[model samples]
Target: MAANKLYIGRKVRDLRQANRATQAQFAERLGISVSYLNQIENNQRPVSAGVLVALAEKFRIDLAELSGGEGDRLVSALSETLTDTLFDGYTPSLQELKLVTQNAPGFAHALIAAHRAYRHNSEQLASINDTLGRSLAAAETTPYEEVRDFFHFVDNYIGDLDMLAEALAAEIGIGDADPGPVLSGYLERHYGVRVARATQNDDLVRAYDPEARLLTLNPYLPAPTRHFQIALQIAQLHAEAVVDSVAAGAGFRTTEAYEICRIGLHNYFAGALLLPYRRFMAAAREVRHDLDLLAARFGASLEQVCHRLSTLQRPGQKGVPIFFARIDRAGNITKRHSATRLQFARFGAACPLWNAHQAFESPGRITRQLAETPDGARYLCLSMQVSRGGRGFRQPQQHYALALGCEVSYAENFIYADDMDLTNASAYDPIGISCRICERTQCASRAVPPLKGRLVIEHNMRRTIPYSIRPAGDAPQS
Candidate 1:
């Protein structure tokens, strides 16, 4: 099959129009001829790698957008354009289609659409045995919901594991050692299981053979990943009671989510046991939540430090009720949770104007903002970009923005608040959460109407913002 080609002409056009740039103006900014820019926008010429990189750098747009792999609208359009015979007889429900496009966008563009043409005329053959009208099991299940709920229980925090791993390593005099050897030694000493590599009949990176009391680990995983997996296994064994107690009565459609949740909870327990909540919280307060210092002291990753910061909200010893979230360049919410009353959109994307996205451009630099809505609710946000899981010369690193924020009134408690520039009444950046969950009436960043509002577009008497809306269930214009 031919490699899937991305035609981002429409996106280029949309962005150009949104920026109010004429073709000649855009061409000059791109350091290209107007005719060349026109050809690229019209799909007469493909965007070169050099030009694509330049556009990403100059316009502050994500490379994923140029490659056409990130946004829902673009993915959905690509899926529709690639539909073949297999999709002809039965039209898919919008939700199922969306799931495919969002989860396996590259696969859909490369395989599903190409296979459709070949399978167009083919049909499922009738079965020989007559089993007509037999009732079948329900086709839908909510495994994702179960997983989501499980993560929600922990508020998506996993700081405990990092502390435990560090302490354990220290005790064994392997605190600064390679993870694979350290984990292998720890597992052998604690579980009486030997770490071995199995080449046949196994599809997992790590698995425990209960019959032999042996733990099999894939040799290909990096040291950090290996250590994490082993620690997670130990956590499951030692923290079963803690996890089951928390997961009790949680509804699950499929056991898969529950199983994954169990593993994740075990990892969290491992970190907690290592750091111990009381000691870690004390250290965190003492350090003013300096992430690098915390990471070094606790032997945790920067991501782990930030994640742990959100879980300091235990009753009777409650810390700040800050909201935590991580986002990629295209504004995909990789993780999110809140201890406050602030709610996020369960579906759809977050607001693009948030400081989290801006952190990607100025990596390693902290960006602080105080945002308010038209309704007078205010938040103080602190965001920074961090990278994960890449090493050596050529490996690709995953970059994400980590943000912590709280209600405006509580902002003074944080270290960043000490800086007058960040706390200045007039200097805060104006931003919002995604439109669906935000109730701000005058936001210029709104991409869609708030969930139930009817758009009121009056061209002649426009507001400062491009869109206006009436409350849901109100009368429509004639």
Candidate 2:
């Protein structure tokens, strides 16, 4: 959103490499000098509009492919990472950060990776102060966090696997009639794997034994979940090589992380297989993103539907960019992904004022909120509680609230946005990423002071909060 000249060096370089073209060859194709092309690829020169048009014409590429989406995402992530107190006095300007993301994205990624390693080390140190050896020796990040970052950076869309799964979906006639029986039949006939639904409560939604060629699914699990699990098993058995290649290319440091990423990719593939991209996107548009209707039609759960919606970042067929997060009752974020500019806090917990937390009290209802972040971006947020496999009283029930949101500009496309006063400023709740980095000084629920602010305490006078935060650069109050 800055006025700086766009420098898409990394993208251009990647494009050239993807086409297996050298600098001279690529320049020749673009009708530009080799030196000029080299400069553009190296970020020494900004990409001209003519070159951009030429690239589009010659390569048959979508002009949107060269847009600032990835750069903006990188800037958001780097900006969040730099918000740490560890980077005090080292925060770069927004323009400077954008330059890094546009030109030297590899370095931007490295900086983020280093910061993650530092945070992981700090957490390890806090948990095991007595065992200094174990804490200091581990320089790598948590496998789960690494995998989460992978999905986050990739915009939650795996093109190859998505296409593969979509083809499978078409082949198996998914999303038509009851998917459970269809998938079960496919597994039995194709893989020679028997699928059995367990009536008794063993607390296992899906248990697959490859050696025995059997999959035992909990009967109590919703039909949608069973169908998804069958799809997942199929993904693992059907496209192990594709998933493995993707995981390998992800550059995970540990085997644990690689295995986790493999499973995550399989799960992603399963979701894609059930709700294939093009058809699902079409359905979402047709239904105005009504989660309940979409779920019923696609034989998926509310959470699955929302999660699939978040991953609609396929090249030209992109859906309205939205952010999705799932949080437990304890306020701990179980899953968070954003295709929008709004990124959730990577710290302790999400902002309490966020409507996602409000869904717990309302259970079956969809809680709608018009929220404005500190950066002044307005979002039409929707939340609802989703139950995940805990039917028996003896079994511990796991419940999490699912949140879906997009910029208010896209509100008309969202079914839950109906009947809301989206134009009224007062209807929108002010929210922040987290307490520690939030610039807001007047939030009643402020639990901690911002890193850049000084606390103003008055023993004689009290306000909503015990102390007022005096942000940096403010003169003595008039």
TM-score for each model: 0.59, 0.89
406 Cα displacement, candidate 2 (Å): 0.6
The most accurate candidate by lDDT is 2
10 residues in a row with least lDDT, candidate 2: 131-140
Task: Give per-residue CA lDDT, model 1, range 252-346, as digits (tens).
Answer: 54577677666656767655544446667778778776667777775666666677666664433555667788888777777766765344444
Q: Give the TM-score of candidate 2.
A: 0.89
Q: Show where candidate 1 strays beyond 4 Å.
A: 1-141, 153-186, 194-227, 241-248, 373-375, 390-396, 421-423, 459-466, 472-478
Return the clash pairs for model 2, or none: none
Give lDDT: candidate 1, residue 264. Answer: 59
Best candidate according to TM-score: 2
Clash pairs (backbone) in predicted model 1: 85-120, 160-271, 160-272, 161-270, 161-271, 161-272, 163-274, 164-274
Cα misplacement distance, residue 14 of candidate 1 (Å)? 56
